[model samples]
Target: MNTIKNHIGINIFSKAILMMVLLYSFMTVSARNLKVESPNGKISVQVFNENNTENAKWFLKVNYFNDGKMAETISSIDLGLILSDGISFTDMKLLKSSKPLLIKENYTMPHGKSLQRHNTGNEVVFTFENKEKKKLDVIIRVYNDGMAFRYSLSGKGNFTVQDELTSYSINQETTRWAEKWNPANEGLYSSMVGEKIQQEEWCYPTLFQTKDNNCWFLLHESAVDGSYCGSKLSNKEDKNKYKITFPDPKDGRGKGESLPKISLPWKSPWRVIIIGNLNDIVASTLVDDVAPPSVIKNTDWIKPGAVSWNYWSSNHGTKDFKTVCEFADLAVAMDWPYTLLDWEWDSMGNGGNLEDALKYIHSKGIKPLMWYNSGGEHTWVSSTPKDRMLTHENRVEEFTKLKKLGVAGVKVDFFESEKQDMIQYYLDILEDAAQFEMMVYFHGCLVPRGWAKTYPNLMTYEAVRGAEWYNNGPEFTATAPVHNTILPFTRNVVGSMDYTPVTFTNSQFPHLTSYGHELALSVVFESALQHFADRPEGYYELPDEPKKFMREVPTSWDETQLLQGFPGKDVVMARRKNNVWYVGGINGENIEKNINIKFDFLDKHNKYKLRLIKDGKHDKQLVTDDSVIESADSVDVKVLRRGGFAAVIFSIIN
Candidate 1:
């Protein structure tokens, strides 16, 4: 009987030991095993998804300083789960505990770029089961160095939903949420001391629904510096939202995937704040400082001052080269540099020949900058060689031929937006252009990303709401100054903007602003390749003073200053080129006010030539210029109604 009892005890002990061993094995397997080493620091990403759970969660912990210090933690809602009423929540809790969790999921970075392991955290995938029992996969990628964060929700869905959302709980009475989100990092929260914090709400979109329904969301916050700009692969429109959908329809279904769509209301792209300091010029300057130079080998191709003929010069008309050359002559005689041959100049069979146009433009001593669709076919061209178009394999070859043709530069159009691949495409084009010595102009694109420093060949990018709409109405001119004010604080910080300034004549187009406001744009807006987008007759019609000011105005500046203003309100900016300082100011609506102008940047011992442009009483649309000689100090000036001013300050040599 004793022996039998012993056998039973032994069996019980063995079972207990087995159970403990199993538990230990499961705990070990569930712990986080992946480690990311980044330039800024190291972080461990833990992903968790279970069959019984309603949602998937991701947790990021930094293993720096041997102890986690300065670690940031945030969570996102799983796109897989169906909200009770199809309503998605921006604020979702991330799973966390003293111990680690287990997660099993598969994902590929939407863009083809290789994923980097970083200390802040790397890409993570979360899966949620919707009410319909469909699995939705969401990707949360965190960049190192607090640049920004990107979240992509892609799966079988009725609509394609792409948004960048941020949620923060503030300490009430201790912090002001608005101040925290502004350009300045210091605010009520930084100044206050308290235990209980208030919950603050602030969220804005970076890029959304362009003319194409493919939506892109950019995170300009510190978490994801201006690194990734999202774009749609397909050009199809979302019938419900009237926007373009992502993931070209052709690529779906072949990879064991169903067509994915996003169906969430998104905010417009917000000015991303990647740096805490207002002087965060490093990223902005990198475009010029880091990118390779233009493909044109000889600086001789660049005339210091010449006018350009935008193929749009004819407004898609049958006007021959003779008529356009006349305009170029007007610019050359006036000392403006270079003329532009917008798109449709390449296909001689349809409109003009690339080689012939180049010869004519050079004969007139005006460098010619031709246009090319980065990817799409020109509407005017019928027999364009498919190989010459902007396809995956032929872009480099086409650009190489243009370089060989002695083309000064190329204006790339119809880029659309920042898809992961498209972002890389822009960089790729810049890299290739560098190899061939060609200058580049980007249109129908998002705001600049400081590529100017890296790729000096990238002369300009058209992201502004410029005078092109003047053909629409006067309201555009009026609203332009307001938009300009907002831009310097937001878009201009990224890089150069091609606002195609100085449309002196009313195209009788649908415009919202006055003609004088258009002229003022020449100085208020900054572009390396500033455009005079009006008939030469319009410029000649200006009074001698205004005309001389236009003739002497320089497009490129060595330094820039924001005197004062607000977005969608009023703005005043001063740019310096050579020895002259050109100041331009504008108001959104009709208003009279006096501003104190500071000449602090000028040498006190030097005298300056100040040429001021202000609205004329006889014609609100026309600007009158006044010239004066003044010593460096401060000047108080009175501006007219719905008016602004411009000044040229130069060292007067006696």
Candidate 2:
């Protein structure tokens, strides 16, 4: 009897000890924190399981250097997705977490805010499994300027993405600058308190400023390819969260499906948040850094420069051959390398046919860009040369014809959709255009998604409410001043913005912005194919000083810096090309003010020669001045209401 009791006691004790050990092991594996930090250690990201409920939920926290210590900028951002088969990644169990890997690389772009870029970040991957036993991996990367994360999935069959449950949650009330959602992405950015924001769709590259720490952050996406449709921020105001939303079924004029259909082993586009000061938002190339490198091996033929555009001056300009030649002449007189012949070229007859116009334009030592309507069911505009780029075979035939005709590039317009098929259309055109050694620009399209890095031939995208609105209605005149000031902080921060800037004369409607303000657009806006919107007569009438400045201004930059100012109030920007720096400033208010100009961006030990053009005593008048200054010097510049100023500074070399 004693031996039996002793044996039973030993068995119970051993079983209890084994059960505790197994429970400890499961808890240790199930709940843990994974972290990655920026190279500079200024930014850090943490991912962890929040609870141990039957349906698990993971959260992310992003911290940045605020005041004197690292502080939380993003409190709790939910990260996950769901598939059509009801496989919920939102309810997942941790499988494994990889060690943080150092990612560093140096790459150069043909033309952008910065030609040379050093990309460095620390990356970590967290693997998880759902109730269905499907695998999902979340990859997180933290850079000095920002942080990004993406989802990866693996399976053996095709799957449809029902929806993404990922969302950004802001803990504090902050000031936000966001554009109302539109397929063409042509809305103006409006400033509002975070609590007052409407529960609606919003555009990417949105700007926000924290009230507590004064930290600035931008929300945008990168690496959006044909496999996924472009997404927008769908605000859930009551919850203080912004969810990732696919296009509506009514998008593309109700043409194709909005949700993404994919094969196994798929990765979603990166959800990027640029964090830090104003300078960090303006000067960072985080967009291109996250995108794939250039796939076009031989990029020698791709040249980015100023262009003389005709559509702004006359809506039907390209239909008349005489007008086409005049625009080409304008390009030559300005020493611009390219001229654009806009819509209706197929109906050319006044001076010559389409071929004859191209011949005359080429004879003047200039390349010409032609416009085509991106035809399908999307737009009602019946512009000619339509339906030529809808199919791959059609694109090949048209691109082949254009290549043989000595055309430099094509400005394909009227995309107006964020559907997967339309996204594929964009990539197909870019790939085909590159095959023929032709450059491409998109007009009436969605905002850029960092595709320029992958296709250098993609020079510019017109996704802003640009100068063309001057021809559309009277509303643009009143809104032009504030709108111009906001773009440098929002839309233009992501990619090349082809605003077609620099218009000095009236189009269909008069501009309320001052002449000085018009001149400043050349520097404030960055585009590989910078379009000069004025007619030949308008530019020819300018004084020698202003004309010379416009003639020599570069469309591309080696470096860019935000000197000072704020959104919807004013802006001062400095851009460098080779050794010379171009500085531009604008006043968004209706009252005149004196702005302090700083030369601290230049070399402190050396002096620079400054050539400045600013508003005179009145808004319509202009004045030019020349001076010499060093980095320690500052100047008080007077600008009229709705006026601006531009300056050229270069080192005084011995």
Point to the candidate with the largest lDDT.
Answer: 2
In terms of TM-score, how similar is model 1 to the real structure?
0.59
Q: Which stretches of candidate 2 lie over 4 Å from their true place?
A: 1-23, 26-33, 52-55, 69-71, 236-239
Q: What is the lDDT of residue 78 in candidate 2?
A: 88
TM per candidate: 0.59, 0.96
Q: Identify the runs in model 1 with alpha carbons over 4 angstroms from their true place.
A: 1-307, 310-313, 317-319, 346-356, 376-389, 472-478, 508-516, 620-632
Q: Per-residue lDDT of 82-136 in model 1, one digit per residue for the tens?
A: 2323535332323222221222222211010011111222444443333444443
lDDT of 2 at 82: 76
> lDDT of candidate 1 vs native?
0.47
Q: Residue 461: error of model 1 in Å?
A: 1.3
